[model samples]
Structures are given as structure tokens and as C-alpha cells.
Target chain A: MSLQRLAIAACLLPGLVACVNSTVDQMVFNTPGAGIGDASVVILGRRHASDYETEPEFIRCVGNHISSRDKSIGVVGEQEFLDALYPWFEPRTAPLRPADLERLLEHRDVARAFTTMQTRYMIWIDGSTVRNDSAGSMTCGIGPGGAGCFGFGTWSNDANYEATIWDFSKRAEVGRISTTASGQSYMPAVVVPIPIIAPVQGTACDSIGDQLLEFLSAEY
Target chain B: MSGSMTIGPDRWLAATLLVFLLAGCGTKQVLVQSEFPPPVMNKLPLTIGVWYDEEFANHEFFDEAAGRAETSWLVNTGQAQVQLWDTLLKGMFRDVVYMNGKPGPGQMNPVVDAVLLPAVDELQYAIPAHTNVKVYEIWMRYRLQLVTTGGAPIADWTMPAYGKTPTAFMQSDEGAVRLAAIVALRDAGAHFASTFTSIPDVAQWLASLPRAGDAARRRVQP
Candidate 1:
């Protein structure tokens, strides 16, 4: 091959490789006339049987993103939401049906607490990100002065998440956003291996948060 | 010779027919209707309020492959049960109030003496694959609770009902399932109504209510 052709190939290869390494798939259900207005929105990670609290990092990231993007609405902090909703924790679970909310709101105390918090909308985030399809291996040796690893390793990560928005005033689900992110990470070393981390959770949070803002802000 | 490399009209026709057949196999919604028995008068004249669990009241089974709701058990199990209860207890009770959704404090009718809450516990239908006979079976379980207006539970019971039917020639699987579900719901309603007033605790509670003579006296005095 000519030097020019090889140079062009070298330039294009990284772009192609990068594209193959990362993927983001998103679906948004926007309510045409729904607006967030001045109501407060709370983002919660639906509790599962294994975990009592949602990932702190994910909650904080989403809260920060939403608060930063939309200045008109107030974002309820994780601690405040948890503290207010602690009394009704037993019935809060994944795949919450519409009836569950109705039942919960039937309690005067619950309604009063939520009203006091000025929370009119709830965003329920569920699902997780995990490492998968790991290949290759690495080993490290420690010397008196320091420690160093000399090996190559590669792994893929997948993030699957869904966010459901519920309007308390309407007593119905207004919209939903589902996102999937997958990427590969690599570590190569001649003497010391530098690891590349796949920001799967961060990507998922960003995608979901941005779409949520769009759905909430749409003039439907 | 490349063994008839040119496509023929017959091959294209065969492919189109296969596609149509596959598409026709998608799930279909089935509506089930039943003829309920006429209303009967209750022995007791106390008014009752009926409340249904939201999930159970609007429950539907989805066929993911077809991307549609295939069956609505709520039709037969939730609405039907409420209707039957109203009918069977009509004469014996003063009035029956149907609370469609959760009621807040002071939202309930003050005239009603007690409330009846029904929740669907389990609902399922099964049909074995690769079966020539084409038999469908349906099962339903309901939990019934009777409570006072003050939220004091009076009585509760769980009832299970089942029905099975064979698919007729040229009949759809969805139709067979619907028929089976109807049969199960009918049997469940009948059994519940028949034995409701006979239960020792329930009968005792009914007997404790104000008698017609006493009620008339109180009204007259007031």
C-alpha cells in the first residue's frame, strides 16, 4: 500500500474502533403537553430484595444533572426523599404498579408529607450496569519500592436502565425513558499496565437525565 | 447446471403464504361474558361498601411476542365478582356502594355499616404445547376481607376456583381460554354467595346488627 493510503487508514482506524467500542441506545416517551413548571421532582432508585438503597453515585449524578439543566424546578435530594418516605418503605419495590401509588397516597400522612415536600412528580430508576464477556488476564508483582503489573486484559461492560415518570396530581404515568449502554475497556502494558475504565453508569445516567428533562419540558 | 438458479412464481407464492401463516399465529384478545343469576334479598338490612385492590381490578395478561394484551382477568374476576356480590346481597342489604378506587379519610359513605375488600391473589391459564386435543385450564384465587368503617377487620377468607374445557374444532385457543375463565369465575361467585351467610362468624356478625324493629324505633324517635 502507498504511504498516503496507509496514513489515511491509520487516521480512520481509531474512529472506527472507537465507534465499535461504545454504544448508547435510548427510547423516550414524551407527553406532548406535560411541563415540569415549579413543582419539585424526586429521583429514586426503586428498592430491590438485595439492596435497600439505590446507588449513591447514580442518584447524586442524576440529581445534579437534572438540577443543573432545569432551573425552574427543584430537585429533591436523596436524603430528604428517603427520610420523608421511610415510613412507606415496606411496599416500595421494583415494577411498582399504578395501584401501589394509589394505595400509598390513600394514607393521609403520606399525602401530607409529600405535599409538604412540594413533590409533584416522581422518577423511578431501575436496573444496573455490570461487567461481562471478560477476556485475557493480568498479574501484578510488588517490589520493595513499588508495585507494577505487566500483562494485557480486556473486558466489556453493559448498562441497562429504565426511568419511569409519574405525575402525582394526575395519578398516572406520564412518560418513560429506557437506555442501554455497552462498551469495552482495555489494559495493555510493557512494564506497567494502564487500565481504561468504561463509564457505563455515567453514560446511562446522563442519557436518562437528559431525556427526562426533555420529556418533562415538552409542551404537551 | 446451478439447479434452477432462476426464481419461479411458485417459490414466491410459497414464501408469501408462509409469512401470512406466521403472522396469523399472533396472540388475540378474547372477551368473556357470563349470565349472572338474578339478585336475591339478604337476611340482614345493613348497607355495605365494596373496595377492590387497584392492581387486581385492572390486571391484564400481555403476550410479549404479539405486543398486545391477550387476556383481561379483571373483566371476569374483578368486575364480575363485584356485580355478583351486589346481586346476591341485594334484598338482604340496605344498599351496596362500589368504591372504584382508594378512598381518602371521610370519603367513604357514612351510611354504610361495613366495607368489603376483594383482592385477586392468583390467576393463570395453561395449555400444553404439541397437544392435539387442545385442552385449556384456568385457575383463580381471591382473598375477601370484611372490615368495619373504623378499619377493624371482621372476617377474611381465601377462595380458589378452577375450570377446564376442550377446544372445539375451528375454535381459537383464545376463545377456549376465555370460556374456561368464565366458567371458573361463575363457579367461584356461586360458591362464595352460597356459603357467605352460612359461615359461623359471618352469620354471627350479621345477627349482631340492629334489628328492623330497633332501627324503625330509632328513626321514629329521631
Candidate 2:
């Protein structure tokens, strides 16, 4: 398919399959006069919470989306960055604020990494997708003659996430972007079950990715 | 119908078979290892001696809550711990020397400022069972002692670390445990790097050392 057809198909995919609605909000404290050039952006998923963790797939989804949209944007791989820094950026030890980043830069090796990676923007993403309000169920069993599932099922999923952008050169949070998305999925079984699954998390990731690309690459 | 039903030879045989299948019966040996990254810190201005005792070097734990013949998990952590601590200590100190025979300051082959000892005080692990949450968790506590050459204690630090799989949907039991252990080890390293100087005795010992050019960098003179 041509780029135009691909774009058209992407636009119409959700309408044909499932419904996903998402909203993006951004607050800019300080904007860089010059856009990000050679400097890299590291998007890390926050995994410190006791009960839940931000999925790694979601972080990669956001990174891939932004990089695909704009090739010039230097988006560092999450695991590579984490391993290079190792214990410093682990779940329990990561700096909670930009001031903490200042403290981390005090270390000689960490400072060297800042220069080596040319990391200018640090995006910390924290949130998770949750499923609730499931109202139906499908039952499957095997009898003497044949085996099949029969029932109707539905559930609601909500994906809410917030991304804090830290300008490493300035040692302060420049802005934050948050996305909220929710969708309902259904499954109906006469003999075989058909699922109309919603991609709420993907919708949220794309929403945040677009806003981030515009923030870092597009002329405002 | 009563929930408690009578059991006979056939039912007993069936229950035993079912339990064996569910538990993945017998012994499972697992090796827990991790690749430690170099800490980003200026080395302390001290040459420390590290002694890895025999038991500490070959430590492994066997977990058996279902009696001796049933489910048993044998996890070996000695080699990984030694490698991790060795790498970590190298990052934290200017020079490190291995000690032989647990020698005191009076007559040691390779003499240093102080001797360091690290041991696992306790370790515990859990896997998803009879629950909706598919999670694997591990917890470890470490005992670290910094002592003078004469064996007088300088600082005794005990710290805890924890790790768990984010989602254990399709991972095997052994794989999940190994991953969690790696996370816990990294957590311990992070804590040690960031919190070592905060110990009162260690702070005092560090204060005793003469100025090493820039105090912020903690760089020792050659």
C-alpha cells in the first residue's frame, strides 16, 4: 500500500474494529528556543509502585511511534539506557525529581554519561491500564459429540498515563503531558466466540507520542 | 452434600497423583545470577581488604514447605553474590585486595586500611499459588561489616532488597525467580552505593582520612 493508503487505513481501522477515545493535555513551564538536534531523548517507564507497573511495551510503543513519525528525533532505547546507568535508574533508586538529577550528575561517571549519551530530554512515564466493569462471560466445554463455547462477554478498559519531561541541560522539568483513554470490548459466542477488542492503551500511547514529537521537533 | 467426603485407597491414589502433578514434584535446581553495572561514583580514598568465607562463597538455599519428598526448590546464589559484590566494591574503593585466612590487622599477608565482609543474612521467595495475581517475588537481607585490621568493628550495616516480576503471564517458574533475584541484587547494589556513607561509623572513619584534593569527587592522591 502507498503511504496515503496506509494513512487512510490507519485512520479508519478503529472505526471498523472498536471504539477508542483519548485526550491529551500538556503544561509547558520552559520551552527550548532551539529544537532538539543531535541530543537524545530517553523515555523510561516508572515501575516503583507497590501494586502496579508501567508496561515496557507501552514505553516502546510510544518511542517507536515518535521515531517513526520523525526520523531526526534521537530516541534512546529504554533498556540500553537503564543498563548503562544500571542500579542508579532501577525502580527503587531512580531520582524522583529534577533536583535529584542534579545530585546524580554530581557523580563523575554519571556526568560522563550525560555527555556521552548526549541526553538532553528525559521523559519519565508513569501509569497503567486497568480493566473493570466486566458484565458478561463465555463458557466452553467438550461433550460426547463436539466441543464449543457459548456466551456473550464485555469489559471496559481505561488507560491513563502522565509523562514528565526533564531537560537535562537545564536540570529542571520543562513540562508534563498526560493522556487518558477508555474503551469497551465485546465477545459474542453462538458456537465460536468473536472478540471485538479495543486498543485503549495503544490510543493513549499514540496521543502522548504525537504531543511529544510536536513539543520537541515541530516549530511552535 | 457435605464438603468433607470419605476417602479410600482409590481417592488417596488420585489425590497423591494430582498433588504431584500440580507441584511439579521432586527437586528443581535453579542458579540465580546477574550482570552488575559499574556504579557512577568517585572511589573512596581507601584500600580495603575483602574476605569471602567458604560458606558465603558456596551458599545456596533449599525451600520446602511441602515436606521432604514433595515440592523443593534449590537456589544457588553464592557465585553471583561474590561476583556482584566484587564488582561493586571495586567501584566504591580506590584499591581492593583479597584477604586469605581471615587475618587481623596485626600480621596479614596483604595489609589494607580496613577489612570488609559481606554475607546474606536471610533470603525468601514466593510464587503465584491459589491467587489471581500471577506474580513472583523475592526478598533478601544482607549483613555487611567493616572492621579494622585487628578485627575491631568499624561499621555493621544490614540492608534489605526486594524484587518481583512485573507480569508473570507466560514465564516459567524458574525463569521468573531468576529475574526477580537479579532485580533484588541490583536493588541492593543501588542502596549500597547511595547509602554507604550515611552509616555513622563509616562517616566517622571517612572523616579521619586526610583531604583527598577535591572532597566532592573523593579522589585519592596517587
Computed on C-alphas against the true complex, the DockQ of each candidate is 0.01, 0.36
Question: How far is B5's C-alpha from truth in model 1 (Å)?
Answer: 95
- Candidate 2 lDDT over A18-75, as tens digits, reads 7988989999887666679889999999988866778888999999988888888889
Model 1 Cα lDDT, one tens digit per residue, A21-119: 334344544363656677788887764423222354677788888778777668898656754553243222222765566655644555677788878
Least accurate 10 contiguous residues by lDDT in model 1 chain A: A86-95
Listed per model in order, the count of residue pairs whose N, CA or C atoms clash below 3 Å is 7, 2
C-alpha-based local distance difference test score of model 1: 0.62
Mind giving the per-residue lDDT tens digits that candidate 1 earns over B138-189?
Answer: 7778788887765677788887876555544476767777766765665565
TM-score of 2: 0.81
Flag clash pairs in model 1.
A32-A219, A32-A220, A33-A220, B41-B91, B41-B92, B42-B91, B42-B92
Tell me the TM-score of each prediction against the true structure: 0.44, 0.81
